[model samples]
Target: MPGLYLIPTPIAEPFVLPEYLKEIRCFVVENLREARRFLKWNFKDLDIDACLFLEINKNALDINEIHVFMKNAMAQNSDVGLLSDAGVPCVADPGAVVVEKAHELGFTVHPLVGPSSLLLALMASGFNGQCFAFHGYLPIPENEQIKKIKSLEEESSKRDMSQLFIETPYRNTKILQQLLATLNPATRLCVACDLGAATQEIISKKVRDWKPEKYNFHKRPAVFLIYAR
Candidate 1:
């Protein structure tokens, strides 16, 4: 029987993909262009030009159509690879629908090992990984954002659980300011940026210790975590 391969793509260097994930060709990707580049760069021996590509993104998610596509592919005993733009799929990406269907249809779902910014940040942040919560993106509005930050901080302090979250790369600085302004001075904040890359930096310091003028993450992929004391 055909299986659904949940392949993890490199978070930074395309050449870093695992050797075991090089065989699969029929792919359901978050972005066709990036997937193509990744395959060509990572697996130079394969003919990426002849590969199959099915896009499953937030803007165009026809669940029924995708369900049919995977079902037909599975019927032929041809494995379908699901690749996320970055990190793992279905964890902040849009492959959950197809993965759930695969399980319901009695098809095997194989999860291959790869790097995840969320996990990498948590592991390196020196926070409470056992009871942590991953909040993908914080609120955008001023008042609501403040309220949410305070609530997350409170929960982190009371439960001794870390709070992990991300921000749109462009809005990263703005969010950092909010964290500095809202979170308690004693709260430890971990700003992990450029994970899995040479320029990666993971700084864990109290809110009062962070200097807004000294740091800039304008368009860098970053993960933020908080552990209240």
Candidate 2:
């Protein structure tokens, strides 16, 4: 295939779908080890050598690196599958740069619609999903990050909008703490965790309702929801 395959994978459980075996010839993912493990378990019948592996993080992959991937993509008429470490290919995760590049190269890019933690969290958030904005990860500096959060809060409150974002898995607790500290107690907050996984959780409460007694957010990826009055 001249273009790329923007393949969508499950949020947490990759082995859930058996059809993943027949989906694409090669997987151009961030991690090949995990991919192999999941595939061997899910589709053990599939030939291992038939799959070509590529490891390129979205943040680290530059245009030149992308060109190499595209060139490899053109080698065979076989399709190239692009997946993230989690969730859908292009939502909050990697694959946007390659997708855009494939389009610029006049390749027919196909997106395999599947599980997206983003949309799942939003729908289950119980927020006003009709008006929502997904501000992926915020800036690194605390000041700029706070500014982005404030802007989202202001917009959500003024227009009754819903602001959605995710944090690094390890720093999830810290982001929750920041949200609790910065967001007004009166503001409505929702925490959606482990979507489509074995130990999934979703909670809707105000910032003021946070309880140190029962809340324990350690080593879990979560979606933060903020809505202005």
Which candidate wins on TM-score?
1
The worst-scoring run of ten residues by lDDT in candidate 1 lies at 13-22
Clashes of each: 0, 1
Model 2 residue 193 CA deviation (Å) reads 1.4
Q: Taking the tens digit of each residue's C-alpha lDDT, what string does model 2 give over 1-229?
A: 3547675655776535537435566677766776666566667687867777776764557778776766676766556767776766777877787778777766788776678877888898888989998888877688887888788888899999899988877887777777888888898888888888888988888889986446655778788889878
Model 1 over residues 142-186: C-alpha lDDT tens digits? 999999999999999999999999999999989999899998999
Candidate 2 Cα deviation (angstroms), residue 53: 2.1
Per-model C-alpha lDDT, please?
0.87, 0.75
List TM-score per model, in order. 0.93, 0.85
| Candidate 1 collision pairs | none
Off by over 4 Å in 2: 1-3, 14-23, 139-145
Evaluated at residue 126, the lDDT of candidate 2 is 85
